[model samples]
Target: MPTSTRTVAEELLYRIGEGDTERIAELFADDVDWKLDWPEAEHGRPATPWIRHRSTPADAAANFRELAEHHVAEGAATEVERILIDGGDAVVLGEIRRTARPTGRAYRARFALHLTVEDGRVTRFHIYEDSLAVAQAFER
Candidate 1:
């Protein structure tokens, strides 16, 4: 069988949910531009990711260099709610349940991504989410 856009998107999220950094990188193209938008902008840490690209697989690997040492590797996470795909453009409307430590409280935030695919990899991605919800989730 061949890989469809919807399949690719599903697999990508599945990989992320599993915290498989390698698999996540594999799903992105060499020139993949990952656009991330965080609701924390007005709080001073304006998280606006216009693009995230690499020239080669090595570049992609390097991009995720920090993931290898992230404290939350064994996170208990899942994409609880989502409205998954759109053929070549995948859109996921969901909330991710994750925690840094096993004893920590689960952080919940809503997300919606508009992804463009090419050669089975994600070429461009634009993210949208309720920043307010994210901020509230992070509240002390």
Candidate 2:
């Protein structure tokens, strides 16, 4: 049996929570439409290193690794409020809490992730989050 979109989405969340970058990358297709809701030009402050443009699975994995490197692992958490699936698309609503390693500042931000699955692999991954709060947390 082929994998369902819901299953793929659930597994994505599980892998992310486990900080398993390899498993997470396995779920994405070679060419991914990746986007994060942070516009550096409008924000004045530069985006965190992890907010760069990514298209390949390797880039996706590297992004997560870079993010993990800048955060404190001990108290990092993701509280998923709900997941809505429609055909091949899934939208995950949640709140993420993490401490910036350099500043030792914690930030909790509401987030929404939209994933589009095709042939059991995610092709589109778009994330919307409170970028201001996250940026502030990393401020020295």
Candidate 3:
């Protein structure tokens, strides 16, 4: 039997938790447009350094490195607070708790994601996160 989109989405979260960008790339379409809409908390600067509008799987994978250069998730944990699926689309409500690398500042944030799975691969992904909290954690 074919895998359900919901199952794929859940597995994607698992891959994220593992910091397995290669596996995460496999779950996206070749031409996936992945975006993280982290708001700007500083003038001309984004809250999270890895805010992305990745247009390809390789581009999406690079986001992990970019993020690591800015902040690391030590003792990070996430909970899928809710998931709703309809046909090829899914919405995930999630929360994350972690200590930032170097700084060792703790961060707790909630997020929501809208995903579109096509041909069993994610074609589109858009996530909204608590940018203010993220910015504060990285503040020096």
lDDT values of the candidates?
Answer: 0.57, 0.89, 0.76
By summed lDDT, which 10 consecutive residues of candidate 1 come out lowest? 43-52
Compose the digit string of candidate 1's lDDT tens values, residues 24-114. Answer: 7787777766545653345333221212334554554554453233225555444636555566777877765544232344456677878
lDDT of 3 by residue, 1-140 (tens): 12578988888888777777777778888888676765434423544546646878777677766666656655678888999999999999989786667577889889998988888888988888887787788777
| Tens digit of per-residue lDDT, candidate 2, span 1-140 | 23799999999888888889988899989999998898855433343788877999998899889889889999899999999999999999999999998899999999999999999999999999999899899887
How many pairs of residues collide in each model?
Answer: 0, 0, 0
- List the lowest-lDDT window of 10 residues for candidate 3: 39-48
Each model's TM-score?
Answer: 0.64, 0.93, 0.85
Candidate 1 pairs with clashing backbones: none
TM-score for candidate 1, residues paired by index? 0.64
Which residue ranges in model 3 land beyond 4 Å of their true spot? 40-47
lDDT over C-alpha atoms for residue 68 of model 2 = 93
